[model samples]
Target: RWSEIDIDNAMWTIPAEREPLPGVKFSHRGSKMRTPHLVPLSKQAVAILTELQTWAGENGLIFTGAHDPRRPISENTVNKALRVMGYDTTQEVCGHGFRAMACSALIESGLWSRDAVERQMSHQERNGVRAAYIHKAEHLEERRLMLQWWADFLDANREKFISPFEYAKINNPLK
Candidate 1:
């Protein structure tokens, strides 16, 4: 929803519960952890969202269903789209696979801390004691930088593909 996005600040806050809007039928029970997740948007993300705002309806949904303007897209929508694009969703890649692919790439890059990347992925520590100790560490600044780098890396390799390790060797931002 538009209410969750702060375009000016380059931030997207995924609330724990959906903020009810008049006339909207669906209520999204936010993240899996039942906690608000702050995602730092990259420049590319902000640009894409700015363009999407032009198509946003009165209900403030960024991506609504084709059949019903008031409702968000169904869970299978993305997978269907991917299948149409010639990908075998079952064998090749599904919607959720993108998350795993990105997480793997981010870890392979070796530029970001594990904590920052996991937090960015909205993953909570499974260990109760560890979760308690590190609960306050948002790592927002590091995540912001990491996300921007990830965007840049993707943009740079969009036309000519290279492995993350090879790309890091050539264009290590820290170096």
Candidate 2:
């Protein structure tokens, strides 16, 4: 039961790379459409997925329960996790907020070009190119690296006191 869904879609039957988006259909190209539609997984995503896979048991569904073997999970589960973490789920604080916070931080950090950052988040870029290309990365590998860095930066700053002033102070102490 859990021996599936290493990478699957809603039904958890097909790899996301091979399956079509739900409720949408086309000719034979439909399934093939998924290939170009993937945002490259970031190193952080990879690491998380890897750990989940291990926790999932052999062939375990990433979202399924081995003992119960039911549907993966729901937003409620996410909300519950938030609540346990003392997050204010009653307010705007929810799971997806991580993306918003990340995008804003990235744009502010200047480590990522605005376009690349949006692509990482699957958000539309400022330029019109985003409308035409959702998952087709013009620079896939570079974007992957940038995404990893973004994740690492967030982790690094999660409980840190260093600020821009500190960085400059350390790097240019003579100044």
Candidate 3:
């Protein structure tokens, strides 16, 4: 929901509950993990969201269904959009495929720790005892920097651009 977005802080908190009406059968819950997901918005993400706000307005929800503004968008929205853009979701990519793209880029960059990446991906801890002790803020600062780097890397190589990894290696071989 748009209410959960703190544009000033550049954070989005996905609550665990969605209560539209009292004792209504049509209420929705947040993440399937039953935990709040706090995502840090990168500069590009913020800029895009800012523009989206202009179109979407400061309404209760940022994205609404095409049929009804009050209803949340369908899960297939991204896939449909990709299809419209001439990308074959089945053969090339799916909505969740972004996770793989980001994970591969981040891991290949050799700039972030595995723990930080896992936490940012919201992966569940295998050990129940260890899971209880984990803090959401763990490596948050590093994650923010990592995300910024990723976005910058993308921007630097949007089109007719060199790979950042190659550029960095050629420019700073000592590292």
Candidate 4:
């Protein structure tokens, strides 16, 4: 929602508890982990949001349904778009596949730490004992740099494709 976006700071805070819209019945709306997720936006993301702000309605939603302005877009929206673009949603790629693809790409790049990537992905530790032992580190600064790198990588490969391994080898700032 627009309320979550902090364009000036290039951040988006996904709240742990969100009040329902008027006439809606949901008690809470938030991340699956029920923890606030901080997303460090890249310059490209901020630019897109800046453009979107011009048409933002009083409902405070960034992306609303075509039929109902107060509600979110349908879950099938991205899948439908992929179908229009000649992708087989069943076999090739679905909307959720993007997350897997991103996760895989980031890991393959070897430029970011595992902690930073997992934090950015909002993945909670699956092992109960491990979760108890692990520290709750946000890794905000590293994520900020990583996300910017990701954005630049995407922009660089918009036309000509480059493998994550090759790109990382050339652009690894940690070196």
Candidate 5:
């Protein structure tokens, strides 16, 4: 289950994925969604979510488990989808790796501080507050942007043959 939740303007109805967190809802995948999961969405993430909206087909849950329907997707299923999508899941490219992927994106973007980055990753907030006591899902915009960027990067690089390190120069310069 997600560690926190926040309701903004009361417009975004983050469901009660877990109890006591009204605005923050856990992904349909539940506990498997990863902790400190405030990873910002790159452009690629936006596109994927937008694309995924269609697959949702008016369903409430975005990522539902197969054969269960009631529970959220598992990390295994997510990685399996990646494997089918051509990623080498066996090479440490599992679903949990998305945190690193997204964090790398944020650092490359130069739009996030370490604290913000950690908060976004849901690793732990940049602030001194413990993740358990912290209830605010900050950096929604940054996460959105981060995911979008990641999505865009993926889309752009899907056809390439270079390693991510090779692509990093094109996407972001090293200091």
Candidate 6:
């Protein structure tokens, strides 16, 4: 999966090959939207990944199973790690839940538009006509800024373990 990351460009191109399919024989297929998802990494993400590169560069995969360097780390692997970190995976959160957390934070930030956030989340438009007209990479620039803001927001609140809304209330009480 690290092969999909382009640290130099601060982007992650989720390959169509990683998408899942119902009837396909191969385990991995393509995206749910049936298109490649290009995620722009924030400055914080780049920094974190830069450090990660040193650890996984030779292996060519960003994360690997503990026993097998050839295999990508499983979702359960992440869940188990989260449990060790004292997070309740069963009720509190799971690996996939991070996306929900990020989406919620992005929405609550009020710095990004709904369309930008939706596009960034790779959510498919239910309206076929609108979907046909909308650009696949719509609001990319804004999405990049939103992602950076999110990472910064997380960094700022990590020590306090407060929600962005709560942090804003304390720091910018009048706003």
Best by TM-score: 1
The deviation in Å at residue 166 for candidate 1 is 2.0
**Runs in model 1 lying further than 4 Å from the true structure:** 20-26
Query: What are the models' TM-scores?
Result: 0.92, 0.60, 0.81, 0.91, 0.52, 0.83
TM-score of 1: 0.92
lDDT of 5 by residue, 1-175 (tens): 2222222211122332434323334443223234334333344344556676667633345666676544556658887888889999879688878778767766765645555566554464445656556556575665554445456567766787544444555654223
Residue 21 of model 4, lDDT score? 70
Candidate 4 per-residue lDDT, tens place, 22-75, comes to 655562578757889999999999999999999989888898889999887777
Candidate 2 regions with alpha-carbon error over 4 angstroms: 1-36, 42-44, 57-60, 65-67, 125-137, 161-175
- How much is 46 displaced in model 6, in angstroms? 1.0
Model 5 CA deviation exceeding 4 Å by range: 1-47, 54-59, 82-91, 108-111, 125-144, 161-175
In model 6, which runs have C-alpha deviations exceeding 4 angstroms? 18-27, 57-59, 135-137, 166-175
- Between 1 and 5, whose lDDT is larger? 1
Candidate 6 lDDT for residue 53: 76
Task: Give the Cα-based TM-score of candidate 4 against the true structure.
Answer: 0.91
Q: Who is ahead in lDDT, 2 or 3? A: 3
Error of 3 at 8 (Å): 0.6
TM-score of 2: 0.60
lDDT of prediction 1? 0.87
List the candidate numbers ranked by lDDT, top first.
4, 1, 6, 3, 5, 2
Residues 2-82, candidate 2: write the lDDT tens digits: 322233321222222423323323211312233333345555666667677666644333665334433344436787888
- Tens-place lDDT digits, model 3, residues 1-175: 7888888988887777765733324446775467887777898888988888887844377887798776667778999999999999999998889888878777766677777777778777878887778755467777877777778777777765655456445433224
Give per-residue CA lDDT, model 6, range 109-149, as digits (tens).
66567888888888988889888888564687777777777
The whole-model lDDT of each prediction reads: 0.87, 0.52, 0.74, 0.87, 0.53, 0.75
Worst 10 residues of 4 by lDDT: 20-29
**Candidate 6 local lDDT, residue 162:** 72
